[model samples]
Target: EAGVAQSPRYKIIEKRQSVAFWCNPISGHATLYWYQQILGQGPKLLIQFQNNGVVDDSQLPKDRFSAERLKGVDSTLKIQPAKLEDSAVYLCASSLRQGQGFYEQYFGPGTRLTVT
Candidate 1:
């Protein structure tokens, strides 16, 4: 199967500006996730979606970040008034349901955002 796809492989934006990233998951996948990975650290789960409904977003910064998967096939993440601390690689991943839980995830190349 094809992997997840993300647009704007790299982006440069000023602090306090707004940016949006898009992701299209593989066909037939039931779960999608967005992650933020900073230099020298593990990827942090920002939000998760099962179909068009959000499954988890405890780690997401609700004040400045928002995401949605309206039709369960494609998703978008946006950051308003971006911060310097927000500079990182934003990753999109998807997985197929296997038995009781989701299976191995397939990841996209990610959108590298540099907040200036």
Candidate 2:
């Protein structure tokens, strides 16, 4: 099975600018997720999608961050007017399904964003 794929791998941007990251999940997976992992903290879920429909996005910062999984396959995350504290690793993950009782999420290497 193919693992998750993410791009750029690294980014540096000034505060108040915008940045975006992309992800492609493993084949045959039914659930996808995006997470923000700050230094010294575990990944925090930004959004979750199940076959193109949003399952959860309560933790996402509406004013500055947005994401979408259009085809239930590839996904993108965007942060506009970036803040200094937004510097972190944006991780993408996928799983079989929520009901499978298998919460083991396979993660991508992640895109590390730095705001200077």
Candidate 3:
């Protein structure tokens, strides 16, 4: 099976600017998720999708961050008017099911973003 794929392993942007990251989940998987990991903290789920429908997005910052998984195969996350606190690793993961304890997910290497 193919592993998760992410782009531009690292990025540096000035505060208040916008940045976007892309992800391609493994084939045959039905669920995809985007997570943010701040330094010294565990990954926090930003959004989760089951196929083409959104399963959860409670943790996503509506004012500055947005994400979408169109067509249920790939996804993208964007941070606009970036802030210094937004510097962290953005990870993409995929699984075979939606329930929390049902499926194991595979994670990407993650995109590290730095704000200046």
Candidate 4:
């Protein structure tokens, strides 16, 4: 099986600029997630979606970041007026299920965003 896919593996933008990232999860997966990995730290969950509905987003900076999984297969995350703190690797992951048992999440290579 192939892994999840993400676009624009690298991006450099000025602070306060807006950016969007695209992701396509593995086939048959019912849950998808977005994460932000800052330098020298573990990835932090930004949001999770189960079949196009949000499952959790408490960690997401709602005022600047937004994400959606319209059809449960693909998703997009957007940041408006991005901040310097937003400079990090944006990751996308997916699993066959969520909330019941342990499920392995397949992750993408991630999009590295640099806020200048």
- Model 4: per-residue Cα lDDT over 1-116, one tens digit each: 88899998999999999999999999999999999999999999999999999999999999999999887799999999999999999999999998955898999999999999
TM-score of each: 0.95, 0.96, 0.96, 0.98
**Every candidate's lDDT:** 0.94, 0.93, 0.94, 0.95
Model 4 / residue 33 / CA error / Å: 0.4
Query: Which regions of candidate 4 are displaced past 4 Å?
Result: none
Highest-TM-score candidate? 4
- Give the root-mean-square deviation of each candidate in angstroms: 1.4, 1.0, 0.9, 0.7
lDDT per residue for candidate 3 within 1-116, as digits (tens), equals 67999997999999999999999999989899999999999999999999988999999999999888889899999999899999999999999888866689999999999999
Clash list (residue pairs), candidate 2: none
**lDDT per residue (tens digit) for residues 1-116 in model 1:** 67899998999999999999999999999899999999899999999999998989999999999999999899999999899999999999998852446388889999999999
List ranges where model 2 is wrong by over 4 Å. Answer: none
Model 1: lDDT of residue 46:
100
Clashes of each: 0, 0, 0, 0
TM-score: model 4 vs. ground truth: 0.98
Q: Write the per-residue lDDT of candidate 2 for residues 1-116, one digit (tens) a residue.
A: 78999998999999999999999998988899999999999999999989788999999999999998888889999999999999999999999886676578899999999999
**Model 1: worst 10 consecutive residues (lDDT sum):** 96-105
Model 1 local distance difference test score = 0.94
